[model samples]
Target: MRIRATVAAVTGALALSALAVPAAQAGEAPTYRESAAAAFAAAHGTSDKAAFSTAAAAEMDITFSNFKIAQAVKVGTTNKVSTTVTYTLTHGADVDIHSEDFATGPYIYRGAFDTPDNMLFGDYAATCTDTSATTATCKGNIDVYPADGELLNAHAGTWKGGALALDYVTGDYADQGGLGTTLVQRYSKLTVNASPEPVVKGKTITVTGKLSRANWETFKYAGYTNQPVKLQFRKKDSSTYTTLKTITSNSTGELKTTVTASVDGYFRWSFAGTTTTPAVNATGDFVDVQ
Candidate 1:
């Protein structure tokens, strides 16, 4: 499946007024709802954590359900990956989801919900259209710009999903955590080449290739060492590819193998991928049998 990699940044300057963030909390990383509540306090001249503490929390009527983030995300070296986040917003009819002061968003993170070690978010706020008096379907975007420094190679792996709704009026909010999990993976690539193309039948055909994946830390593609890659073949007249054998990549992520040449056909290498990388297949290289 193809994904758009030219999208924007993962986080944007929320429309929160300058009153939202005081100089004291400028550099702090807050949870999705905490930031929204702080915006309300800053705008209302109240910088205290009262808006978020469980002791003074107001009864929230809005909640999120049916969160749908992609099962797996493949991020490459340079482009920003833009993907959609969708969920169902269920709230009391009195709650105004369309209000300018009310905002909702989706996110994925590692660690605790209130104090995650790392997180990825949809830069834009979510907009919900009412499906009923109390239910609506909402859509938003989650973008990843590798060059923006929001991710490291170690960041690729399992991530948990969450959603939040904040009402600027009462500074009350609803947050859903551990809704599901998604795999954040590096984008993989492969290549194939068969030498001495016009060899006689029964001659040895030396095939060489390499397996690599995106390294977000370096913003480059590096060899993925010690991974199994399938050496597959297909006849020139047939569309089917049969896996001839599985070869492991060397310390340099290189694959070299010898196959007995027969009829005209194509040869390629395929990687099954891992928890931190997406599967990939190289374009088939055709060889002529003399």
Candidate 2:
């Protein structure tokens, strides 16, 4: 299968805003519906998790239906088939199997809590499990819990001209059988995806980069909206910043900045920015030509 890295888009500033303050701030992490929503979006972006979940369910016959091991083939031998095969053989005999299944649920995620907290009980609505030759489906809420070892953190603010942070707990389990360990992955860094700064004098060009869930922490309940990222720039040769720009990032975390070049001296430019909405923590830098 062709694997593509998925980028989670924060559609609005509100999503990032949910993680503005660390849950540890008030002796607990601050969470809102918006942050939960962001976390959900981030989880959906990880293709591996989704694929693993789908693959596991099919092999386990945990879906609505089950598949019988109709045939088995050995690499060099043809008739060495057994009446019944182990779970390892059904999925991939030679391949190392992990996680019994995959699931994302429970609306509320706490950053400060060391373990799972059912702040907002989440009910699974449906499940789709597919194999190369067979398909299965499950109706109604499935009994899914946060995988073990799942780490949840909240980071708020703007990084590189866009709101960036870990909204809430989002992760993939080594197994989805509700027994495997959960792995919390970081989203992409919030970025300003603009082209290189122009070198022409008085020719101000926009600066931008891309944002990902790894870069920003978010929540699963709250929806995100566009928010401005913080940026500071100065001439490489000069001591002080030549210009400071506050630009808003799109749903994809793209920012543009206009900057004019030096007319007299040979100059290089550098920039620094953050997406610290309620607070400033996430920061980044970029280069612009003379």
lDDT of 2 by residue, 1-290 (tens): 11111122244211222222122244543233223233333333322232123223223322111212212111111111112211211233422222222332222222212122212212321223333433322222111122211223332221110111121222222121121111122322443333344355556555554333322212221212265555555445655544355655566555556655443222222223223222222233444555
TM-score against truth, every candidate: 0.82, 0.28
Report every candidate's CA lDDT.
Answer: 0.74, 0.29
Worst 10 residues of 1 by lDDT: 1-10
lDDT of 1 by residue, 98-144 (tens): 88777887777765554454666665678888899999999986767
Q: Pick the candidate with the highest TM-score.
A: 1
Could you give me the TM-score of model 1 versus the true structure? 0.82
> Model 1: how large is the Cα RMSD against the reference?
7.1
